[model samples]
Target: MDHGSSHDDEVLGKAFDLRLMRRLVRFLVPYRGLFSVCVLLILVLTGIQSGLPYISKIAIDRFLTLPWAIVTVESAPGSGAPIPLGDDRYLVEISSLSPELRKEWEISGVLSPTRYLFVEEDSDKEGIALEHPDLFAPIAGGYIASESALRSLSPSETLSLRSGAIAGLIRLSILFAIALIVRFVFGVSQVYLLQLTGQKVMYDMRREIFGHVLRLPLSYFDRAPVGRLVTRVTNDVAAINEMFTSMLVNLFRDAFLIFAVMGIMFHLEWRVALVILALFPLIVIAAFEFRRRARAAYREVRRQIARLNAYLQESISGMRIVQLFVQEVKANERFAKINIDKYKASMRQLLTFAVFRPLMSFLSSFAVAIVIWYGGLNVLRGSLSLGALTAFIQYVRMLFEPILELSQGYNILQGAMAAAERIFILLDEPEEDRGGGEAIEEVEGRIEFRNVWFAYNDEEWILKDVSFTVEPGERVAIVGPTGSGKTTIIRLLLRMYPLQKGEILLDGVPIERLDLGFLRSRMAVVLQDVFLFSGDIMDNIRLRAEIPEEEAIEAARFANADFVEDLPDGYRTEVKERGVTLSVGERQLLSFARAVAFKPEILVLDEATASIDSQTESLIQRSLTKIMEDRTSIVIAHRLSTIREADKIIVLHKGKVVEEGTHTELLARGGLYAALHRLQFAELGGGTDPAPPSPSFSEG
Candidate 1:
């Protein structure tokens, strides 16, 4: 099997649709409250995020300018003037004077606040008079003070107003930064929470799907591919993880981002915003078209991959048959065809995404071009400032961002829809017969089939009004040719499939009225094609119960599988996939051991001896007598030697019973039973046996 075929042969087309999405959405019904909380958080985060760029523009326009406030104090050469802080530095004016001497005057005020050094050289704290009249000036109200001013209070007042606006702009920047930090923390928290929740849902869904699959009637498996069903639980569900995470989160995020940006832009200037409005329809139209095509392509890709997987699984399981028949080339050719189909489908899917992604990018670029062209002219005409024009262009870019997001979200939506459809299909399958009433813990294996008729299809009947009965604890052998409904009868007995028209009873109770679980638990079966799990021998035998090592060993011995002890690790010896480490005879013996471990009230053996060599068959024959001593057993066999000592042997031909009696009695009658006996005896070259027929025996 070529592993590369899986990647190369996947299908790509519009196989999933809106209906499947609707079905998947129903799974979230239970988590609506949690989802609502997530949505609200996303909305808040979106609003905060959308305003970030605008806030940046405002900060650039206001605080980015030089200070506009100046406070002037005319203190008659003594009272200081406060110039709004230069950046982070403070400025003080000692008197209204020329800008040239202002720094010297402010230096004195700076030292006065520090320590009042020198105390003006007067040694008196109350007042200090300057020795030099040239350095100090008295106020006009004081004595002979004349003050002339340069750059008067009017200019300072204008600067003060600008400073107020700048302060508010700085505050806005700080607020935006806080919002950004909050959004980041919330985003990480939301992702972690949603991922955990999604994984939990996936785990529960896988278990539910697996249990449902097992409960379905066996006939369902006949129509459905095993590999495809496995994909539904594994790969298909995995594909939806993206939808379960981002799709749920971004549905609110993108919606809020687009609307919030649009609203702010409209408030800024309706004329410039209208350009964005005109391009909105085109962006939406492109998104919808791209989504429709991308979804189809993705669904097709999934379907093809599923088919390829099924083909490979079936091929691997039947590898020996292919080798024995020398059909490797033919098998490879067939596999190559499926692989090619998948490859083509995947390419188509890639192409769909390629086109869709670029188209979105182009639409977003077109919106940006419209803003630059229109807003640039408004700025030139003095209708809008350069800063405002820059901000409007950014808003246009924001409008197209969500279109890209929604496009990606569409892909997630489609994958989830496909997975949901497969899950729903499995959930809808019919369940196996569970019986209408409670099951009996103790059952007398006196089973009777009264006028049973059935067919897998409506065209022909496989079992034609079949009727038979076996006494309790009787070792009855049902002998028939291939396609004579021998296996069909056993399947119905297990309730693996419902009988079309019949009543099978254990003791005097109808089998249909018994609980299915109890009935299967009490009835053990060993078939020709036995399935083995990948585990130790002990694990295989004590499948449902944690039996002790001693008990497991004892059960293995009773089934004559003590050869397991000679292996490298004995009972703990690991079995490879499908029990590949053991030969067919060894695997069959383990199956027998498992059946015996269950201690079933009734054991059904269907071709259990067919795969073993003569020596192994003889070993089983010895164990059979003791194993079936107290338990009722139904043995469907073709080997005459195995059934020679059965308490009763029923011969069937073409769904009709031809003869029934003790082995010797049937031989004496020389009917279909005698002919089968002769065929076996002649083939084995066993000339004759001394066993005699009862003188007076009844046959029907």
Candidate 2:
């Protein structure tokens, strides 16, 4: 009931429709191994990425936090000896010393000899002496001090401490480097594997959709515009490809990343992780809204693009008519209107993305601010280490990246869903019925239309009670004015459309009961308008059939297509789109050659030579007679002169058979056929006679 372009009316569907997703997943079934590899790589990559921040935390807490100072130690009297504490430091036991001696040691900046600590002092007084200066002396260069004492290290001790600190820093740096390299490797591998899997899946989907389009009923195409179908097969399929190659795998990757970051944050500090989690609902809301608007916008974009394409295809195809009628300005105006519609749709999609991306970024930044504020307080309160707080900040930032990416991926998913809906709709269309009847390897060319009535649309009959029969090997010419159901009869015989009220028999077997391919293979029909694909002449003749090159050439010769040999490439001569480089007569000859190559048992010509000039018509007529010989031929012609040699003639007018007989007998009857003949002859500047001799008349 809608009357809008079918492409425009295509439903957008839900972004995550389960039924549609299930259908999409079926495409990945054959590539499960690749998909498995990509999943494994994503998991590994996420793990490595999550661990890097923890490694930084370790460097901050362990090695970097160690104190930087030098200590002085004294051997306890004679019984006390210095004990090694490893790494160029020593300890002494002073518990055995007398209290007076301990007091003396304490006054001299020394603890019990066993546990001496470093103390800081003025560099200018490095050599200054005191009453107990001899008692407290730095071990490496000057005096000994207590464990609790603060002393500046002598030059030698300073060098040793600096060297140790540098070594620890180097070790941490090496660990960081290792983590960085490992993460890089896994990241690259993950991306490559995921993209490869997506590409392969896309390839499979495109192939399957194209194959399905080829098998749809011809009647479906009769109503569907070429441009809309092209969009379905090409542009719509590409949108789905973008989803596969970018969105689908990235969806999993981003989810893994977000969860991994959350887990790490919680492990470091649950309270800080909760701060980030509190923002998740907001992000989810934004994502949902983005998906909704984006899906609608993208659907509009697709619809507009379909409209633009259809207009362009129509305009370019009918350019000659437009120019001849001086409608160039009007045509341009129409094109500009369609083009602007598409442009507006595209900009809407752009604006949606532009707004959503930054909005996501803003949410992510707000979450990060929350983490920094809360986590910073915990670090300052001494409840959380500075390193842990820093890691939390990093994790929070990483968390939002995936959220933002998830939002963008959702955008891709929405577009892909719209595309998938259209594609699946096409795939769901019923294929042409191949029929369950017995197959026929061969058939006598006998055709009969028994009281057949048909309409392309609801009771608006194109043919009413049309009945006729042609025996085996009989040449029957159907003469009619335009729209008299002559061509419709030919279409019905070829089973291009279903019969509504009658049966068509081929060789005494109803065509509805014949194998579609076998039935079609037995007959060849050439239309008044010739269509040629962009290929060499030989390919056009052979089509999908495996006719040998020599045999194709022989068929061409039989059809009097000798002009092909005169072309630069001979049989290999390139035919541009629609065979534009060839003359009208040449295209007709090629069609004849195609029919001849197929070697059909029945031939149907629907005014095949109606458009050619007088000279070209003569050439085609000679080849037509050759191809029709010994073959049961049914010719629909406006030019009565062309059908004069037929064994029988059936005259049609207003969807009914007005008369039937051979040419002379039909002329003698002075019915529709005679009137048409007289009109055609008079147009050629000849006078009509009641009884004329058998003269060679040129066809219009």
lDDT of 1 by residue, 617-677 (tens): 6677777666787788888865555577688987777887778898889888989877766
In model 1, which regions exceed 4 Å deviation? 1-26, 29-33, 64-176, 546-549, 687-700
**CA-lDDT, candidates in order:** 0.69, 0.75
Best by lDDT: 2
- Model 2 per-residue lDDT at 257: 86
Q: What is the alpha-carbon lDDT for the whole of candidate 1?
A: 0.69
Regions more than 4 Å wrong, model 2? 1-10, 67-168, 437-442, 683-700
lDDT over C-alpha atoms for residue 504 of model 2: 94
Instruction: Note the clash tally of each candidate.
Output: 16, 18
